[model samples]
Target: MSSTTPQASTTTDARRSFLSGFGKFTLSATAVALLAGRDRLALVGSAEAKTAGNDVTILNAALAAEQEAIAAYQVGATSGLLQKPVLDLAVQFQGHHKEHATALATTVKKLGGTPVAAKAKYTFPVEKLKTQADVLGFAAELERGAVSAYLGAIPILDDRELAKVAASILGDEAMHWAVLRQALGQPPVPSAFVS
Candidate 1:
């Protein structure tokens, strides 16, 4: 994805216009991904009934986190505090989140469980931000949480195929964190991610 350089002076009209367009673009992209996801699941055979419920529960938790990541990106994209490039990156990350959510939801359905719909309201680790830096910081944090969540689930999953899927998605989440860090002008990978 290409990044746009921030304009010399961003006006209220410019920010509003960009946000409106961005929202429409994101919603459309999410819809397409969901449709593709349903198609993909039709090809995979169902797992054993005994293990299916456990797999579905784990996947549902990950799906919830993916939904939260999507929400976080939406906030960053429409906040108007970020430059176009940064906002575009936020949208890109949101797209990945949607893909992950769809992939997991597909898995849950294949396993014979109802896919959980993410809550409309979620609690973000980062509170309201007073500056652009704060927003990017929150984005980075969300990506990291997603990365950890996927990694933790990968090892415990009984299904090897789903484990592979989680591995791939976790890798993408790691990349999202790096991109978010770069956007914030922080080290792409921190020396120590946590204390």
Candidate 2:
């Protein structure tokens, strides 16, 4: 009976260890699946479906904001107010907005939704671009708007990965705003916190 007791104890320990290892493996596999774009909630297909729908709506709104930013930059770049160097910078900022739009569109499609297209004509203050200062001021306002939109999106997005993406874009938009503000002879860091 003494030998049997030791054997039983060893068997129980081995079983516990096996369960621990198996649980770790399962968790790791789930993480990998999520990173690979497999929606875990979609596997069950009920509650998560609604969350996915909400995510699609938020992502489409973000895409539209990006499109608007791109249009604003295009107007500023072509207004004949910016010098060569400033125009180059405007184009660069526009490219960033385009990249954001592309990523948002891709994510929207991945969520089974169509992206909102840019309007045929956006009502930007094109007539207000009378000088370099005016152009920079307009671009700065648009960048600030982009920053606000992305900042708002970070909390609304259901997916952590999507929130991370929005945070990244927020950083980029904030930088654009700061630079444009400096160009407009305003304090770049207007406040300690952007809130």
Candidate 3:
């Protein structure tokens, strides 16, 4: 939504605070993206092993967020509020979230941690989603929160290479947000900073 939704705004605010202390842990990526460029992410150092437990916690949190995004897209796709083109875009965005979830789960397992499973339901504002624009607005709000979440986490990652991988994913999420805004006849990227 051009004017932020309550849920998305709250999540973004909370994540901003959580990500401020993100340096306490680190992520070590090994090919997190599959969009292009082979998505190669190598550990720059062995320091991450010492903080694997904390890393797992953070990764699981991000995984949970991505899963939520996937579920949100599913809700939008099946709401019968979107046209053919919009529905196709919603599906494609869901696929991206699935890829993100897969990569997060893979990394969590590599760190000897269990991935966080998706919940049976997420509290979406279904009553507010009455039109195609309403659905797009809901999705845009989620994407904006996602972009802010990833952006807030990227700078604080202890591993530079891991941050690089995260930046790539952040770029993808930013694109998703921008596209949703454009589809809603709003500015694609309203500001340089996600917040």
lDDT of each: 0.68, 0.72, 0.71
lDDT per residue as tens, model 1, 1-195: 232222323346654654564355432343344444444444455555556567778989998887767666666666677887777777777777776776677667766678888665554433466578888888888778888888789888877767877787888888888887887788898866532
- Candidate 2 stretches with Cα past 4 Å from truth are 1-44
Clashes of 3: 0
Instruction: Write down the lDDT that model 2 would get.
Output: 0.72
For 46-162, candidate 3 gives per-residue lDDT tens digits of: 555546656677778789999888767767766677898988898778777777777778777766678998775567777778899999998888888887787777766655555
Scored by lDDT, the top model is: 2
Q: List the residue pairs that clash in candidate 1.
A: none
Residue 5 of model 3 has an lDDT of 30
Model 1 Cα RMSD, 1 decimal: 8.5
- In model 3, the runs with Cα more than 4 Å from the true position are 1-48
Which residue pairs collide in model 3, if any? none
**Highest TM-score scorer:** 2
lDDT by residue (1-195, candidate 2, tens digit) is 111121222245443643453344322233334435833444647677777778889989988988878767766665567898888898788777777777777667666668888766567555556799998997888888878887787898888877877787888899999999988889998998776
